[model samples]
Target: MSPDLLLNQENALPWTERLNFARDIARGMEYLHERNIYHRDLTSRNCLLRELPNNSRQAVVADFGLARVVQVEPNTQPDSPRKMSVVGSAYWMAPEMMRGEVYNKKVDVFSFGITLCEMIARVHADPDDLPRTNSFGLDVEHFRQKCEDCPPAFLQLAERCCDLDPSVRPWFSDIVSITTAIIQELDSAPNGKYDITSRGSSIRRRQ
Candidate 1:
């Protein structure tokens, strides 16, 4: 019953709407981390967006059925050696979760990377487009193009978010910093417009 499921129906949104949707999702996850809550389930289906009366957007993390409170005991192991439960969608699950290994908040970071990629894909492809088969199989070309007129810092931050090593992933605070910086730059850009032609040319060169 999440609002994301309701809003993200087939053929439901235009590309610009999808972009704003992804931004709000990133903000919601950042908020969760600010409160020290790890939303173990961060798939697209679990994010709900609410429209404010001021014509702005807000999002919330929903479906906490798989969420866990991260313990902060230094060098302490679970009292029972039982394997941690594996939950969440297969495509979005971090490698450690798939292996049933005990992990910390970084697992959620990994899943966020996947979610970011999925959101980027939705910006270019039809809603009915098939899911990608692998991480690298994502449409980096499309993303790079859309970001062509965007500040370079924004594209770099998005790439860093998808880094393979969880240890290297940016913390929520870092994400907030980068996102805020980029938003400022975007706001200051002429007409809040980007050069899609340059983006398309860049994609062609890469291909």
Candidate 2:
């Protein structure tokens, strides 16, 4: 498991770098889904970061243990199971998967959204670990959600990704576009500042 960003970076990465990591994961998911590949187990622990110069990190999606190809089988039955047995880490598991309902690549989108919370908070995505909502779903924009440490744009996209209805979740392709736009906006801004929680950053939330 990735205990923290960069595998073992003593200091927490800047907010922009964390956002870059999020983008890289989104691109990786887009690549897999484009070819009908389903990464059944998507989580921060499965994602590896290759350190680059100047504190930048390249996020690589690893651990394909539960990966499945959603290809049509010649002799498959119409109702054959497509990994509906509730696989993946419990924390990152999607609602459909948790309910043991038929699911698809959209499950990964849900995991991605939860992973965003992990990225922002540097904490586990388990329920009530951090400030959350009474709603049964992950809603970063919820009035009670304490995701203020994360970027508003990132939080908004994560909210969409975590929609309880799989059909409402955006595809990894759409996620790529949104992350690209966010990175662009960050770059174009004049000396932008962000809330960096913990790890001796400029912003720290005292308990």
Candidate 3:
């Protein structure tokens, strides 16, 4: 299931399930980053999920049409490799990318943050529902407001992923680390369900 359809079908997923989704994505991104590949367009729509036997869905990172291979310079950090082309969905594009500045693999981290926002807020990152554009950019304040009721740790990870400065953003491995912890906590919880009460509209979950 695509995340948009998943959210539309169930309104909102439980926190544990959402954490699982994020962890899956983080692991996927981590794998790609390890190979010096960047999924330039890492959005909810690009991720696919396969249903499991026990009322669970396993996320698979798909849609690599916009993916690029980073050409690392000798003795340079992986994130230091720069690319000039401006590509990827606008809603999830990093701030540096929107500015048409040279960007690196960290841009994917930014997109992952936006995808995480979608899972938490049950909303797409694009406020205007417009297609990706170099002239367009995200409103971070609005996004943060939409993330109300989201776990603080996850929200903080989102903030770090979407940081304006590419150097300040964490690597995909770091994301996998944090999400792994969150997933473990959730799995150890009662019935793997967190006591999350919706803050706004009723969040209908799938049985």
Residue 19 accuracy (lDDT) in model 3: 78
* Tens-digit per-residue lDDT, 1-207, candidate 3: 454554573564677678788889888988998998988899888888898999778888999998887778889876674757889897888878878888888889889877877777776566553223343434556665765556667778877876777777888788888888876765564454454445323222224
Residue-wise lDDT of candidate 1 within 102-165, one digit each (tens)?
Answer: 6566666666665555554333122234233344323445456544433456456555665555
Clash pairs (backbone) in predicted model 3: 90-132
Top of the candidates by TM-score? 3
TM values, all candidates:
0.66, 0.79, 0.80
lDDT of 1 at 7: 38
Q: For residues 1-207, what per-residue lDDT tens digits would candidate 2 score against the true structure?
A: 377543344756666677788889999998998877789789988988887897556999999999877776689753244655578887788887887888788989989988887776666776756334444467554422554555677778877887888878898888888888877765654444543445523332334
- The global C-alpha lDDT for each of the candidates, from Candidate 1 onward, is 0.55, 0.73, 0.73
Output the lDDT of residue 189, model 3.
46
User: How far does residue 118 in candidate 3 sit from its true spot (Å)?
Assistant: 0.9
Candidate 1 Cα misplacement greater than 4 A, ranges: 1-23, 74-83, 123-152, 191-193, 196-207
Model 3 alpha-carbon drift over 4 Å, by segment: 1-12, 129-141, 187-194, 197-207
lDDT over C-alpha atoms for residue 111 of model 2: 90
**Residue 127 local lDDT, model 1:** 21
C-alpha positional error of residue 71 in candidate 3 after TM-score superposition, expressed in Å: 2.6
